[model samples]
Target: MPRTEVPPVLVTGATGRVGRVVVDLLMDAGVPVRAVTHRSEAAATLPADVEVVTGDLTVPESLDAGLRGAGAVFLVWTVPPATAPAVVERLAVSTRRVVFLSSPHRTPHPFFRQPNPMAVLHADIERLIAAAGLETTVIRPGMFASNAMFWWATAIRADGVVRWPYGAAETAPVDERDVAAVAALALCQDEHAGGDYVLTGPESLSQAEQVSIIGDVVGRRIAFEELSPDEFRRETEGSWPRPVVDMLLAAWGATMGRPAFVTSTVLDVLGSAPRSFRQFVADHATVFIDPTPSR
Candidate 1:
């Protein structure tokens, strides 16, 4: 297949957290962007300069339209039926490069050895992208800093206590913005072709340490209380998907006695240190604040 002549980059999952950030970074770099959302309603948030398209990966015809006239594509499999040969084939024939947002599978640590169905699906996509002859960049990010917001923001906002299992478990949480920047760089430049980048934050910190950082950023005294494994499971029983909950608990349990691996890839690629957990909380402090303060 010939190169796509730098028409525009197609960003699937454009309305999602990392995708929106990627779109912004690409636009900042003056690269024309074609943003693809699953529904027309989701397109409203995209900037007016972006060309928004409604596309679904489950249906091949839907993806073909979005794949047209694009130099490269950022593939993020957010929906189910994770193995889609037609979608990969369409991208292979229509585009020059593909950057996949994937997870770590072959990490030497036992924590990453937890059985995760998502990893299986991402591996399948990586194989298909390689076999299809498209230049591929596979990015495997460690635990996301945003996960803290989802896990503890509510409790901290309400009662100043972050309740969770394995508070001593360590992780090097990567910022979503850093991940987006790397993805945009891979999409717009050829230097990262056929590269498998393992992205992580600068330092390894325990869960309790992360909570304290957030508290410092938010200007409040928040406490971290370790929950029993069974209690934690019960708390998230109906709130999260069964497989995801199981995988997280298993990973956290395995990490209890070990330290998380840290890397400087963000600094190497973006020429700056990855944003610390405190910075993330400071940037998003308003999200944890109640609009109507209770007396």
Candidate 2:
């Protein structure tokens, strides 16, 4: 288990919120990268030097070329549960290590302990990885800071106001960039094998406090208005899946008046502090600024 130059690593979901960044980090480290995506168009966005291959995780057979000669694989199981075994088996046959993006189901934190179906899926995948005898590492990232783009960006961009449910509901929003960085290291290094890292921001902040921090970073005096859970539900009913909406409502309601769970795992693994929500906002402030306003 000593460090050595690894063969090309296959990055599934390479065009995803975190996978693209993982690909970038791997390329930066001079680690060979084979970016896996289902669509040929996604290849255009990745670094030209990377070996872009079309592979669907749900269909294990499609991954043969991408997984060939790969020393490790970054696995993100975004599909349904039925095909997971075949995929993991193919991965086990092709690579010695796998770094899986999973949920913090075992963290004992109320924010992450909700009875969510995705958590169940993640658990099943983790079990598969272990059973397949792949040297595995599980990365459990809490609420992603990028969620603001969906949760509040439109309102913030239009009117500097974030109106949503449970204004004081607390949770640490970890940065996806940090998640990718940790994943890149884990994918390339043997030291992180058989590890379970529950990643989170350095500090906890409530929904309202997070909005305020974004406002500060964006140089705007934004306002946070508490909304009824019903309002949020009604607004997102058609867009988000019912189970997801239910999980969110349950999690936020449970965390009302309580601080989110914070962990030192990011710093412990990376030897540096995880990016704060403030820093995340500052870096992506443009996304909060309106481009077109009502005339």
Candidate 3:
């Protein structure tokens, strides 16, 4: 595992929300990037400067082209569980370091005590990465600010009323850009190796408070109505996977009477406070504006 002055870094899930930002930040730091995706045609969408290559992490042999000459890798596991061992093992043999984007499992809080299938997968992959003797940096980001779009965008667009369960459940939502920035730093520098960074925004605010902040930023009064667990389950059953719904309900329920876990890893790593929820809403406010016309 020889280090170079400026080695090419491989970014898996290059086109995804956080991955795209990671790629941009890495490139801005003068690091050559190799963006890996399963679909070769998707390469057209990435920047012309990026070396877009087709590679499937689950299929280790498929990663040959993308892994070649790369000193570090940004791994965003988006595949089935069965192939994780092989993928991580292959990564260990291919690259000098791996920066994995994972959830906040180590946070000592009720909100993270639930049984999440994704967290299970992340743990398994992390063990594999360590067993392989690779320099690994695990970034555990708390609730994402972008979650507002999935949870309340439609209601905000329609009537500006967010009807949901456990509005009192507090969370320190970290912006995806901050997550990406820290990840990019890990990939480009040697100092971040062996670091387990738990990232979150500066403030710990409840769901209702977050919505109110969004309303303030968006220039209106958005109402928050707490829904019953049963109602939330019923509404999301047909749309969201059962396990996912159960996980959210349990996490939110557990955090109802507790404040979310917050950490200053973002500031420690990037030397600045992470983006606030209000800024997130202000930037993407158009998405929450109702598109339909009514009489």
Candidate 4:
């Protein structure tokens, strides 16, 4: 738990948005890191000193090999029940502490409480880990600021008009970097066991308002248009799961009528302020900037 103790950290989802950041942070802090991924090629971007292990979380046998000698683990639940038992079992046997990247289901807001099936899935994993007797910390992050890149990056780069559903629905979008920072701290230290931290940005903003901040940062004006829920569903059906679609629509609907919840857990844990939406936009603007403009 002290700053002087350094543990070998195994980070699952090592190539994902937050996982990669956690890996980098641990390495920067001089902690030994074992980056776990399904493909070794994905580990190429990581530091050569990092121990890259190819293992499937769905297989308990594979995890023992990847987790051998590691003292702490960072778990990101990407799949369903098929892999939960095997993964948690391995971590319980091998690791001293585990930090779970999860969602805020017990938040009591209709947005978070909307009979979410996926919430049940995460809850199941949480229960599994707790029963296994490992020191556990749960991080529930609100909507990520990075979601905008997937939702409107193409449109912003091509037509410069970002169209989506519920433009006025409010959300306190947490930066993925902040989430990763907290995860890194929890993984490297043992003091945060049994902590359920709800991570959020400093301020709440609507989708339209977030876009306006992006526009301001880029020194350009961007337009936002709302789509009917049906139209939005049809457009996004191929990309989003049905349950996730329902969850988002319900959350957005609830948000339209009420103020979003903003939390300072990132500051409380990491001793610094969470990044603003404007900061996120500025940091990732290249994703939306036009690659080729008309001559």
Candidate 2, residue 255: Cα displacement in angstroms equals 1.3
The model with the greater lDDT, 1 or 3, is: 3
Error of 4 at 58 (Å): 1.9
Q: What is the lDDT for 4 in model 2?
A: 79
Q: Report the lDDT tens digits of candidate 4 across residue range 1-295.
A: 7566555889998889899999999899888888988777888987788999988876768878878878889998786678788778878778879999989988877678776787898899999998999899999999899998888788887777887888888899899999999999888667898899999989989888988887887777889988888988998878888888888888898778777888889999999999998889899988878867679
Going through the candidates in the order shown, the clash numbers are 0, 0, 0, 0
How much is the lDDT of residue 245 in candidate 2? 88
- lDDT of model 2 at position 110: 76
Across 175-266, the per-residue lDDT of candidate 2 in tens digits comes to 99999999999997899998899999988898888998888887888998877988888888888888888899998998877889899988
Candidate 1 has which clashing residue pairs, if any?
none
Candidate 3 per-residue lDDT, tens place, 165-192, comes to: 8888999988999999999999978999
TM-score of 2: 0.96
Off by over 4 Å in 1: 1-5
Quick one: best lDDT, which candidate?
2
lDDT of each: 0.87, 0.90, 0.88, 0.86
Which 10 successive residues of model 1 have the least lDDT summed?
78-87
Off by over 4 Å in 4: 1-5
Off by over 4 Å in 2: 1-5, 293-295
Candidate 1, residues 1-295, lDDT tens digits: the string is: 9765457999997988788999999999989898998788887899988889889887778877778878999999976754478899899889999999998777778677889888888888888889999999998899999998888888988889988888888999988999999999999889999888888877889999999988887788888888898888898888888888888888888888888988788888888889987788889998777666789
Q: Which should have the higher lDDT, number 1 or number 4?
A: 1
Please give each candidate's TM-score. Answer: 0.95, 0.96, 0.94, 0.95
